[model samples]
Target: MLKRIATALWGKFESTAELKKFGFLAAIFGFIIGTYWTLRPMKDSIFNAIVGMDYLPWAKMLSLVVIFPLVIAYSKLIDKYPRHKVFYILISIYACASLLFCVAFLNATLGLVNTVQSPWRLIGWAWYVFVESFGSLIVALFWAFTTDTTKPDSAKRGFPIIVLFGQVGNILGPLLLNARRLGFANSAPVVAICAGLMVFSGLLFCKIT
Candidate 1:
């Protein structure tokens, strides 16, 4: 029976409420992973378009420098605030920053329209670091929140479900935002969509937690 198969696969739940909690948690994980995957290719393409691929190593080096401060700030926030509050704070910051970048991409001077590849093009470097730091911080924070909240027995069942959804998002996110469909001319549309997903994920986190 389908019930037997699902029980075997996902383990038995004590209550319907518990099952629903895991389902929502799984969705939150999926959204975060999906947004990260979607942004990865966009980061490279936009950076290449605006700054040239030759400078990629420099941009990555910049990301390393930027991430340390970000992680430190994140740790301070975690220490100062409740975990859910920290999640909201960080998610709001990222969602707003993403939207700002989406709008920035529309500007002729700051965006892909500025085809000149100079080291002085700071937007490209900033964007590369933004996405890179986002990947590291957001994913780590989510897992930290998950482990803090989940009981060990529930996590055995729930973590697998969450990972499964995250993997699904990982596969689908980039596939949906492929270059052929969105084209390389403007990244605004893709960035806008990613921002929306980030916002939705934050909302989901609020609801679930």
Candidate 2:
């Protein structure tokens, strides 16, 4: 039964010209939530541990000013490359990118630093920045790739289905993220598994796009 559900969940988007666009716009919302929701229950614990209550709002301010804008700018930067140049490399790059995001998430959750004043503490927060920033970037790039793959008319249909798959991931990811507080020592491994799932999703997006 699990195999059957898995098989059904992890399949290519069928090439129906009419259905491709369905997933396009939905992909954005799907992925935004997917990244956000992936670490849901433990978000506060992780944030407080790394950035601390004193620092989180400031960090969020920094992210809004720097990380968030860069993410948008990077998405628009897609236009800089010759359109045809976005090929197999996007997948490999995104996979590597996803791995980094996961590592960042794990490091933040572990608070693997001496103290808030330690240089290592900055590194953990930096990882947190990267995880949140790049995770959104990954989703944006995924849709951009899909738009490039589908015909202008057909994309409207397929996009929704694409988002649907990601939405499933978003909803399910939080459900699975419940292991965060078991022990600090084990946090990285669990986050790594979550990251692996993210990368696998990236691979699927690459395959279908």
Top-TM-score structure, candidate number: 1
Which candidate wins on lDDT? Answer: 1
lDDT (Cα, 0-100) at 75 in candidate 1: 97
TM-score of 2: 0.62
lDDT of 1 at 144: 93
Off by over 4 Å in 1: 1-6, 182-185
TM-score (C-alpha, index-matched) for candidate 1: 0.93
lDDT of each residue in 77-136, candidate 2, tens digit only = 676773324423443454465466456645534343423443245644655565556555
lDDT of 1 by residue, 69-115 (tens): 99999999999998888888888888888888988888989877778
Candidate 2 RMSD to the real structure: 6.4
Per-model TM-score on C-alpha atoms = 0.93, 0.62
